[model samples]
Target: MQLPVETTDSINKISELRNTNLQNILKKEIDKNALWKGLVAKNLMAIGIVDLTDMSNIKYAGINDNLMMYAASLPKIAVLLASMDAIENGELEDTKEIRKDMRLMISKSNNAATTRMIDRVGYEKIEAVLRAPKHKLYDEETGGGLWVGKRYGGGGDTNREPLKNLSHAATTMQVCSFYYQLVMGNLISDERSKEMLEIMKDPALHHKFVNTLDKIAPRAKIYRKSGSWRNYHSDSALVWGPNRRYIIVALIDNDFGEKIIRDLVVPLERVMKKARNLEKETKI
Candidate 1:
């Protein structure tokens, strides 16, 4: 899907600050580690990274733009935005129940809770919200996997396409761009953005990524979400620093456990910290 005109403009503005150093940084990372070999050994498909701090500086380490993988729980971020939009427009109230379910959907990756929240906001509303001024959603429609309704424990086939097929997935690039808009308060109200960040702060729900991050950079505040399927695994995070924010996305469709974590997570954290420090020093 084409990015909206306003979004294009914003992207152009951010792209002007493209950090060329990040390219060499990531290239050296991939070359230095044998984890890419392990990822291939496990039949991994594709991995893509986007630097949200500077949209124009995006780095794709694996396959090119054609690579598409199942979004899994990453789409929940879009759902969360839609729900918040509804609440802000007075179409839906931010009741205790709504807040509770939103928290569950985001923090816990609770499919049932997500479906319930989607039901409240309605699918059409979600679609419309994404097509709004500065947000966009791009993907294909395909068959066979976990239907949203059934996957969420609801009792209907809904005749909808299954959520799995690689053909019906999104690029890591698009997902990261969508998230950047949300983080910068361009997709929703500031109040809503703050609310969403608070939900992301829930350590219990974000344990998978946060736990690893805590070990390496305990003092850093990182907000992340992960998705997994039979052979695919992905994690996207916004690392908050004293002077800058960094976006890190790691995707592996392999079973190389410790290797994926060490090569991707550990080194990515180091890169992010170095980027953060450099930005602070340069006052960018």
Candidate 2:
């Protein structure tokens, strides 16, 4: 249970330029929207967004990011990363069957496929990938993000996540960090991270965030994972926009969770475009 001597230094040590600017802009946008305000009044929602186009001028923010919520199928992103890690460590084989299963698990959100992978790679290894010092997508300080406590199927307890004890738990900040690491080629290794991100690219499931984002930005490439179970609907993605690149994650626990995710896309895209325009103006 001990981390490396310095493991807890800080999980998101990429760039620490305070979230004030991003928060202010996002708050203004969210507050001005009537539907968004009504949705916020009803249920739990967590959001994390960052503009990756300019890492040097990294702008990022989150709302209720620390409240760990059931991430549904989203934590499968952890499984994808763990599979790559195991292959690199020789703990798990990189066979066609394994790769296919991973693809199904991710792209299709196939629970059976996910269980096969969870059994093969072992949940411990997946969590290891999250808690790894180099990655630490889920760590003690962050209250343990991206967790899979029980089997996806053939389940019994189906209880909750480990560190925080919420079934299939995730934090928006952690999910975004995972994507950030993948984009920056820091999840495992540059080569392995790219391979994993490629798997996440062009997700097969087409609802919620995918549906909304695709409608708004037809040309953009989205590497995403989403989960909709009862009242929990979650979506997170690394969006390669035509003129901007950023990461956005939403975890909503509400009756309107799906619609809420759908409604937020264009607005977030506009924020990215605005940031880009300002960047261009400064250059000019």
After superposition, the stretches of candidate 1 with alpha carbons farther than 4 Å from their true spots are 1-18, 37-66, 139-151, 154-168, 206-208, 242-244, 257-259, 272-284
Give one digit per residue, the lDDT tens place, for model 2 in 35-145: 666665553888888887775566777777666888788888877888888899898878999999999989999999998888887766776677777876777676667
Judged by lDDT, which candidate is best? Answer: 2
How many residue pairs collide in each prediction? Answer: 0, 2
What lDDT does each candidate get?
Answer: 0.56, 0.76
Worst lDDT run of 10 residues, candidate 1, spans 141-150
lDDT per residue (tens digit) for residues 1-284 in model 1: 11211233244322233355554565566556676745544445344444544434543332222245565676677668778888888999889998988888877888889888877877667657645545544434311211122235546434233344332244555555555655655667555666777776634544445656766666666666667666556666766644334666655666653246444666665565565566568875
The parts of candidate 2 lying over 4 Å away from their true place are 1-18, 38-43, 156-160, 275-284
True-vs-predicted CA distance for residue 129, candidate 1, Å? 2.7
TM-score of each: 0.73, 0.88
Number of residue pairs clashing in candidate 2, backbone atoms closer than 3 angstroms, sequence gap of 3 or more or interchain: 2
Query: How much is the lDDT of residue 138 in candidate 1?
Result: 42
lDDT for 111 (candidate 1)? 81
